[model samples]
Target: SNRFSYSMNLKGASMTIDTACSSSLVCTHVSKLHLRYKDNEIMPASVVNGLNLMLFPGPFVGCCAAGMLSHEGRCFTFNSTADGYARGELCGALLFKAKQFNPADGGLCCLAGSQTNQDGRSASLTAPNGPAQEKCIAAVLKEVGLTPTEVDCIECHGTGTSLGDP
Candidate 1:
């Protein structure tokens, strides 16, 4: 079973942040909020993703499992003989300015808004809870005054495991 993976460096706009699965996405949200604040003026339309890998399994196991390896010399995206996603490691850098640079200095990436929720239930210890998931997402939509229909994308943590889907 594959267990580890790696990626190279990436670019950023104003500041580089690191979170777990929500890191890259959170950074993007914050950037938008900064733009709304009108502290800076630079905000790129598109952003780039950084290298991120996930490894380690013990307390629990989901539907997804894999690994990473360095064979001869080249780097691999997803090898053929690989099993599942070893460990999930992801890094993302975005282009954005701050809401306030130096008090007198203006032109920062004003944050428009952001939303966050949680999966309250943790089945055994590392399992995902559905009710909690629904509540969190619902809260975000309510805060934004939008409906689920307005959501265009969903970056999920399915893990390709039976538990994740079934």
Candidate 2:
């Protein structure tokens, strides 16, 4: 399909990520790694796209059965009323380049570093593990040479599920 082949035309290594919720961030981490180790001249840039179209009713029904959808139809992230998440369609894309290429010319900022980890042996495959989440955050902060106190802002995937929300 054109959607998949379009990236191949760029003449650089390309791959897809299917990790629900963390797919985009994970892809960014991989791009950063390629820029760090691969020849910048050959693969000077990487493009990451995340597209979600939730018009279908199949997944929605599953989420409802699992109690992962907001009964009130809202995402009360970090709030006392936090229940479940409201699903919606989202489309976003980001371009990354090696530091030497000065990607700032095209974008306001560049990725300093990134890290990824998995929740091995969790209670359930769908359940979020707190210890694994903690480890992932600590690892990324260490990779970027920053402490928890030094960071002011953090973007999180607020799934809005009772068990998933912190």
Q: Name the best candidate (by lDDT).
A: 2
Pairs of colliding residues, candidate 2: none
Task: Please provide, for model 1 over 16-116, each residue's C-alpha lDDT reduced to its tens digit, 9 standing for 90 to 100.
Answer: 45664466666667656555554343442434345655455541243222222223223332344322233444554554444343435443343334565
Write model 2 residue lDDT over 36-101, tens digit each, in one string: 899999988888888788777999999889888888999988776779988889989887877654
lDDT of 1: 0.48
Off by over 4 Å in 2: 1-8, 100-104
**What TM-score does structure 2 among the candidates reach?**
0.87
Each model's lDDT comes to 0.48, 0.80
Q: TM-score each candidate.
A: 0.45, 0.87
In candidate 1, position 164 carries an lDDT of 42
User: What TM-score does structure 1 among the candidates reach?
Assistant: 0.45
lDDT of 1 at 95: 45
